[model samples]
Target: MAHIRSRKHAAAPQPAHTALALAALTMPMTLLAQQAAPAAAGAEATLPEVKARAAAETPYKADAVASPKFTQPLVDTPQTITVIKKEILQQQAATSLTEALRNTPGITMQLGENGNTTTGDSIFMRGFDTTNSIFVDGIRDLGNISRDVFNIEQVEVVKGPSGSDNGRGASSGYVNLVSKTAAREAFGNASIALGDASRVRATVDLNRPLDIALPGSAVRLNVMAQDFGVPGRDEVKAKRWGFAPSLAIGLGTPTRTYLNYLYIDQKNRPDGGVSTFGLPAYNFGANTPGAAVDPKNYYGSRSDFDDVTLHMFTARIEHDFGRGTVLRNTTRLGHTEQDFVLTGVNAVTATAADPASWTVARSRQARHQTNEILTNQTNLNTEFATGGVSHSLSTGFELIHERQNQVNAQTLTNTTLPASLQQAVANLYRPNIDDAFLMPPFKGAYAKGSTLSAAVYAFDTLKLSDAWLLNAGLRWEKFHTETNGATFTAATATLPESLVQNAPLSLTDNLLSWKLGAVFKPTADGSVYVTVSNAYQPPGGANHALSTSATNQASPSLEPQEGSNLEVGTKWDLLGGRLAATAAVYRSENRNELVSDGATPASFSQVGRRRIDGVELALVGQLTPAFNLSAGLAYMDPKIVRGVPGATGNQGGAIVYSPKVTFSSWATYKLAFGMTLGGGVRYVDPVVRNSNLNNATSANLPGTESYTVADAMLAYEVTKNVNLQLNVYNLFDRQYVAAVNNGGSRYVPGQPRNVLLTANVAF
Candidate 1:
């Protein structure tokens, strides 16, 4: 059989709404002349309020979200949300978004499929795939790549159906990353760090006011560079660098304009993972399994590599219309390019009696892909009163164009060589990195697709009384997607080889989603609320590519999947509003799944259903004047009520990769002499890789076992402008499996004990 190859294009056409979007942005500038007098007067009133709030803010707590759609403060919001401030990330020395997410519960990582290794942050949340539900500054950030936090100020996680907040997305929830921008202050900060595994990193953040040319104007810049290698895994290394710049004008005035840009470049050696032939329940020709293989074994060739380049540009305008009303408009252009070639262990050949003679089959995989997005959004927020009822209303309109192009490759072995070498086989016990292997050449096959969407949404929060409040939101969206691709097939007996170039396929869908909530405030610092929300996932929603297979869920002929959630929660502020506590119980369900319909010709229908019932608890903010804490616990029960019979891991049992119980907590205390000590513990229950009617593991072997890990941090403030910090990860050096492939053929081992020390300077 021949492989299907693909390639990507570097450029794409601008969206049709570009002109209109630009008009919306420039229209506000015309009001600058008329509002000059009022703007100056308004500036005087806003500056003092901002200064006072900044002086009273806490390091680890946020009172409200950056988005204007959420009209109420955190205490009054009905949804389940967690905000991880930059201070927490700094103290922990977290470099990637994956490490920062450890502060939350009920999230798991995923290894790739049977033949390939997953790269980047492949996140699973609340029993659903949330890899594509990440956003930056209220706009979707689409790609499969690791994200650095050097330019990030905070991370906000919202759990539950949120179609009203954004557009179509996963059933679980979404994450929003807040970027650091210009501020009306002069400050500079820098850090340099060194760690085990030849790790080195440096970062800098600087902000300054430019009042000489434009009053109230400011500029900010952030830069990062890193080079590191995996401690236990040999020949695996990553090198990356990035920079972000932001400019703001009229910050304190009634009209504000902002410009921002970001650029990143990465080069890395990917890991393919170790074979699972000797592990428990790994049967080889009816032979009993043996001891596990060395976790440090590097099975891939040294030629494998992954590289990425990213660029983004944004412009925003905000104009105060006076009387508690504001108008805002934003435009963004983002592009990402990635190319990778990796070697994975596919199967084990244990025919030899000696374990040293055993070998594992290797498979080559490569992809050249590019993702591009252009979006424009306009919003209006106002406060009004009618019939003695006060209302806070938020309305917005959005236009988006997202596209993805991927070029695949076919691998051909050098059959002239020896059998073992030509077959791409590596010794199971002792694999060599300098092995003879052939690099795959790119063919002409590729896949290209794009999605265009137009949407309008509105949200209203009504104060029925001092003790009662009602919140409602609704969104209507229309989307169109087009796909074009080609595939190849090798020649067979009595048949000639062929290359099939498919005609353009298109899908159009209209979606309506909403949410409703009611809150009851029994006291000044506490509230109870109940909310119901729904979201939709249409064909080509997560990715732009559409499939032609009848059984595939991304078939354009299929109906969109529907998800709903019902949650009841309560929140309280304690110790004179220094601490926040929250608890919630929720049930979420997804319907319209594509499944085989037991028919003679094998028909399919959209009658499948699945559900998850969970309980969550959280605490954040200062426990006392000298202590701070952030912690969360989650208990999830996932089940499939209907599905295809005998489907791997889908037999009326718990969903694959979904843990039952997860807990995470971190706390720090300030001591005398400007010293601080912090530590955290994380726990995850066992998960089943395969399921039958009895919900048993596959082949009667146990699934991934549960594990507990701990981390510690110590910091000393030598002076007001200088500090030193150290972080220790996996202090106990516990050996465990971090992730396993769906077929149970391979696994990635957890990181061993490692430490890093840094010197931080601020002025």
Candidate 2:
């Protein structure tokens, strides 16, 4: 672990007027105490009065306390925002980004290839994939790659359509990762962790004064490294190491600037696992555990891969002109490159009885991506008595550009013998197998695409006679995209003769998206809000045409997918804001729906429309002073209202992957002597694969079962600067699948029960 140390500078205490305003809002009880003071011998009581005044004037304060004024109030935001504080992450001994997010409601994670570096980890929110909308410190880091969680301050999940503030692509919601920043006081901490699967990790955070000889300049550094050993289930192994360093320069009076950089390198080797389509749907009946093969031999010898590198950088400047007027400018850049190779079992010979005789086909894929973003946000807000009405305004501008490049290749060996015979000979003479067989390389394909977006939005809140407050907002956006790609089959000897050809394709789209909303606050602690928002997505390379479409050509001249959502929600704070709860009902309609048939991978078309109606309830904050609780429940019914010819049933049921019921809850208790203990449980109902049209044979396909998982953690403070923690994940050791591929043979299972121990020291 690295060590961080920084000099301390104490700013002058706030002026008397500002202090009075804060006291009026936060400690009205102080005024009551003053009013209740007994009228007595004033001359003799003068000394006590003076002492009380002096106590209020004391400037000394705890260095680690969080100021209420600096923290944003949850009630002020219209959307549902959940925050996972740094203290919680440490107490939970969160070893990965996914684990940290699992504690949040309405979020689910799917591990890639036994949690290997080469596999792409995916997150889903509200039934929509979230790979393209992740953010770091309010900047978009949109790429199909894994993100490292180090030097993180907190994770905020903003629910519902956030286009008004976050620009486009936020149809479901957005995740914001706040990075650690230089503290104004001296502080440093280091921690080491060891866990199951031979996992070892070390992390350090340090804040140091840049100019101890001068004043007002500081630098902060954070670094993390982890090595995950091979899992007991297979021969897979993964390792990742990364660092984040930042520098802050305090310009003379009211201006500050900062620069930060991130570098991460990860590598892994994955043994061949079961394919989704190669296995039976039901694993509980008539199937012996590990019956297909010895659990030890499940990993084939030819499977291997690696993820090269990922890099990111960001810089920003903030200026305060005075009196609630501020301006902020920021820029961010990121790049990723990956190369991987895997041995796949030929589908033609993938039979249960002859599974051992299945031949292996080698393949490789390489991908590169880059993203750049620029934003200028200005807020001119003021509160004053104007005709007995007070108003507050917020507005901003944002621009973003993202691009991606991908190349893929595959090859097969023609041994001119039965797969069983080939496997036997290859095992006996491994070295001579390559020489005796004819290798035909599969021609590679490339894809290039880009997205450019710009938006300007504004929202205002007007206090109507104190009791009723009115809120309104509007956003306008322009989005454009272009993509071109080609596939070549020249590398294979049988391709040209068998009608295989190289073809090039291109696509482009430009459109506008907008949103509007209003809220009525009847009381300080309760409010009702309604919103109408429109979102759009331009068809890109990934959703482009393939050879299997009915016409043998891509859908001609695709249009932008558009949606409008109407929502009504209520928020309330109970027990002096210690307990918060929200309930919302929404109806969203989508046009130009992207629909695909299971008959062929490329059989995709745009349907007329679809609609989804749902309700959500969530609660957070403290149930009592000693017990903290968080929970969420959701119900959704999504269905297609229109259908095209040859398409399946449209209005019978909800869409695929949209489970009707989901619930999560967590509770923690504070104990004596700086110790805390907690536990949580999560449950999700089974989801159908093809909800619109279900066949009995396919109905038996594995739906995510309704299962419960439990986690617990214990933390003890050894000293002012030292603490220790122990965490147990999946306490019940339940075996369940997280996701299944189309073929039903490949199932991604949830992690087994695991334990981690951590020690931390701070100064």
Q: Report the lDDT tens digits of candidate 1 across residue range 616-708.
A: 999998888889999999999998878766644353877778899999988899999999999898998987665445444353233678889
lDDT of 1: 0.81
Candidate 1, poorest ten consecutive residues by summed lDDT: 7-16
TM-score of each candidate structure, all chains considered together = 0.92, 0.77
C-alpha lDDT of residue 164 in model 1: 88
Q: In candidate 2, where is summed lDDT lowest over 10 consecutive residues?
A: 12-21
In angstroms, what RMSD does candidate 2 have relative to the true structure? Answer: 10.8
Clashes of each: 5, 12
Clashing residue pairs found in predicted model 1 = 5-408, 5-445, 6-407, 6-408, 7-407
- Cα deviation at 677, candidate 2, in Å, is 1.6
Please give the distance, in angstroms, between residue 499's alpha carbon in candidate 2 and its true position after superposition.
Answer: 16
The deviation in Å at residue 6 for candidate 1 is: 56
- List all candidate RMSDs to the true structure: 7.7, 10.8
